[model samples]
Target: MQTEYRYITESLAINDYGSGDRELVSVNDGPGELDELFQRVGFYSASHDFRELCGFIRRFPKIGPYNALLLHIQRPGCTFVATAKEWKTDFNRTVKPGARPLVILRPFGPVNFVFDLQDTDGPDPFPEDLLEPFKIHDRSREAECRYALDRLLNAVPADGIAFYPSDFSTAAAGYIETAGIGSWQKFRGHQLKVHYNHVVSRNLPPVEMFASVLHELGHLYCGHLGTVDKRAWPDRKHITDAGIKEFEAECVSWIVCSRMGIDSESEKYLADYLDQNSRIPDISLEVILKAAGMIETRIKKGIPVPKSMKIS
Candidate 1:
């Protein structure tokens, strides 16, 4: 039996996390309307992904995803940013007099003002490799693929999800099963634990291998595997339709891969399914988009060290 967790809100709100000029509005429109609205999530328009969203995300890995986006909205070319105090103490840099500070929402606190590297004058104290590890650059096509696979392998252990080697290479490349919690991850509302085993093959191209992990993560984020922490994402495990699960995951794979400039075969899989059914499967467009956004944010720079692993 799956737990009936608090799922995606039936109602959608189109407030720009403080970046939009328009006032917030509640969208009570059905799937079609909200579906259209969700795609319009770009501060400017839907086609904005061709711009700097991914680069902005990769450049500011220290801030929470929402705040990083807020920073990008306020200043698109922002480099390293630190609080006035942090700039002075950690970086030995001082904010230039009269430099207007950029604001980001402080976690559990009021707003915080942080100065970008451009606004600061300081003795360079960072090691040569300071952010080199977190940057997004490709040495070659093959290197990018290898990095994708390696990053996913290293990144999953943070969430208590372990991946093992496999021989198969298609999207059904792996299986996910509960491993029974070996330990507790950082508790949010309550003590939450995940011991998930995902198996994927290394025989495929890097892009295909990467999409396979994305496909599997699609299931976890969609609540098909059940929720370890609803605070991170809603758990809709009670949605017991196999087709819905596959459809949602496929949609997520398509959405994330498209944004990352990687082509996915999931598009063909989805198209074939739709053509055969002659109608869209009953899947939550909201959840599918949300899952893609989450995954893309994490991988936009590269595989990210989860928030849990960040401070652990």
Candidate 2:
């Protein structure tokens, strides 16, 4: 019993040990019973396989992290010799077992002893629907950003002004009408219409275009337009309100672009905006993060957005 207790304690220590210590301890006893045990429990192999298994397990929302790990390693009908409460609460299956208990770490709580696959049924959880919504095709960051941008553009509401390639003599790279008669004509309800200058679009890289579109979309989604009166659109206060609106939009663009691995001038833009007056809005960080997540999800799902038939 004392030997069993020591073994159990050492096994638990493996989880907390550094890589060197773990490897040393696993091999120090000279490749006998413990080595075989490590192999059986999946501690002997490279982490790549474990990572893949974890990725697969993460896709299933019904399974908890600990349960997922156990399901990955534990075999069917394995005996789980945990406490009665653990047996009742954690284990899905219970069977009579006469063999000695096998000490295995529980997914949660303290260390406990379990028997073998024959004594208890193990979990076999999987994604409910085989079809995953967000199937990203482009592996490169720039390509992915462009793809996401295209999807977002195509999803603009019908009432929103259609984006078109247009040659503008002015230096502006893009424009969005947030207020005034132009806004009333272009915006539908909450949707904001944006247009990119063809000269700038053609000159800039696809990633830049992605950044530009995301910045514009950030303005629309952040409720910047709704904050101002349509008649009093482009108000000086709105543009320079301690860089509130611009900072918010640029930050959104920066986050989304960064996640997609696209380099952006959003930081520079934010710096310039902040130069006007160093202050950020009281906007919720959760709101910005959630919005970025939603946008990325929409992009990955390949939500169809019709091309603008009207060319300028």
Candidate 3:
């Protein structure tokens, strides 16, 4: 019976079979029989800090096996069980005899229970501080990011790009425009003029400005600003499409900014953009990755900008 139970459980786990009417039909035995089978199959013990377990479940709501295991072991009125060591370590409380043990399967170590959680309507078990590190603050590392972006900009050809602070509205953080007006053109071939919102750049943290600059740079380097006739360029209509342009540029920004530990809305922007478009054009992932890599490399090299070409 023990061997048969193990075989059945392992089969269920591997194939993810037995759905709807077939679910738990074969395991219609009493709780004592199921408990004995679980114990035999090495599922008799588990542990976790109450808060930590709650947080883990909350963070990964779709964890199927763990959720199923919890449902299997949890009782309606009885408080949960904890190992003596776990109770001592985390709760500094004693476990009564009537509490049942919750089993957890560890990948590497001995299976053990650290703590048991009882149903409660009280405050959250995990404190805010536990999750604080995961939050992204745009200004927290602005100086480092600014230095990196400045270095990247410095590596580009001096004649090909120019930056200026403008009195644009707050909505416009920064933008890039081609330098030439007509066939005569003001600057050299395909040179770009980047404009940063002066008030926002001065008043807000530099991280937002840095991200905006990188996004515009992404458009320039990723060929979004190039003529449709250019080699490897997307179709003219797709290139001119706002959704496609924003998606590609934001994807570039996300790749580079994430690599540099800078936070941006690029992921959200890309996700929303993609969600709205049913048929996305074949944008080259390799191109985006390569562009991001080149930009990162340039920034990391820390090339010095000439004083005459410096943008204030």
Candidate 4:
């Protein structure tokens, strides 16, 4: 494959993905949602937290020119200034005029999620020409989370076994592997002991047990919790984003239980959870796909999920 090249600000130190070392290329300019994102967040400065933010984003494939984009999202930023047609026509005219914008919504500060926009999928090729701007939400996502959780918990079987609440902190939710406990291998084997002690208390209703078990199952099945590194996380908490982990797990659990004829309450909780947590009114297809990965086996083959036994 021919490598695409783009120029990043000298300060950001972006990896060169393509062949050329050129500073800028407007080769595939187009009118895409990514362009709209750029118009939303405009121009970076010499010193901004964006440097760190870009550093994080650049690690992923299909992501480039993060520093420049981060610069545009920093404080004292102009919203929709850089991405407007005026700037796109001038700076990004080299690309196709009608590509769908690639949008990534990231959390910023205490209670806001910012949507970072980009045009090209792979390399920026024209990092010099790319512009970014900030768009902030003035609220918390707690409500959405509660709704999603409620929906997930309400949909499971209530008669089987006791369930315990895991003592995982919110911070640990980000980098969790959804695959499951088995994936964590040695690290989880030990950590589960500690978490088990903290969370396991009394016999829980089968449905509740199912919900909690399903939640962890979602973590494992989705490969989220399994990917955690106990030492690397802050305060021994998992390093993954909490909202993403919880929401995805909940989405998976809810849908799966729903398919298995678990109960109406599970559906109610899931509906509520979705209602309260999602920033956008609609659920994304990615969420659906992740959820599907979790519950597909149980629904298809009627596999009995794991459970804790009660002592007489």
Residue-level lDDT for 64 in candidate 4: 21
Q: Which of the predicted structures, 1 or 2, would earn the higher lDDT when compared with the native?
A: 1
lDDT at residue 148 of model 4 (Cα atoms):
39
Model 3, poorest ten-residue lDDT window?
A: 20-29
Supply every candidate's count of residue pairs whose N, Cα or C atoms clash at under 3 angstroms.
0, 8, 6, 61
lDDT of 1 by residue, 1-312 (tens): 011010111121223221111111122223433344334542323223312454465445456444555566567777678899998888888889999787665533445789888898877865434444334544234566566556555555655666777887454567677776454444333333446878787677777777788899889866777655554456677888898899889877766555444556886786566546544655665455556655654443333234553333
Model 4 misplacement above 4 A: 1-202, 227-239, 264-266, 276-291, 298-312
Better of 1 and 3 by TM-score: 1
- Point out the higher-scoring one by TM-score: 3 or 4: 3
Each prediction's Cα lDDT score? 0.58, 0.44, 0.45, 0.32
The Cα error of candidate 4 at residue 47, in Å, is 36
The residue-by-residue lDDT of candidate 2 on 1-312, one tens digit each, is 355346635754464211100111121212223334544554413334533442443332232223323334443233123444454466554535564554333333444555443554446432224223124434346666656767765554321435655554334557555433433123323334333211234445677777776776666544454423221112222344645677667766766665444557885674554455433344333224333443554455433322331222
In model 3, what lDDT does residue 106 have? 36
Residues 1-312, model 3: lDDT tens digits: 446445544544543322111111122112223334544643432222221232332332112223223433343222333457755565555555565454333333323343345421223363443334335555357788768756755655332455565666557777776654321212323333332111223333567777777787667655666522232222222356676567557766776665455567775675554456543444433234334544554565532333333333
Query: After TM-score superposition, what is the CA distance of residue 24 in candidate 4 from its true location, in Å?
Result: 39
The model with the greatest lDDT is 1
**Which of the predicted structures, 1 or 4, would earn the higher TM-score when compared with the native?**
1
Which pairs clash inside model 2? 77-117, 77-118, 78-116, 78-117, 79-116, 81-114, 102-114, 154-305
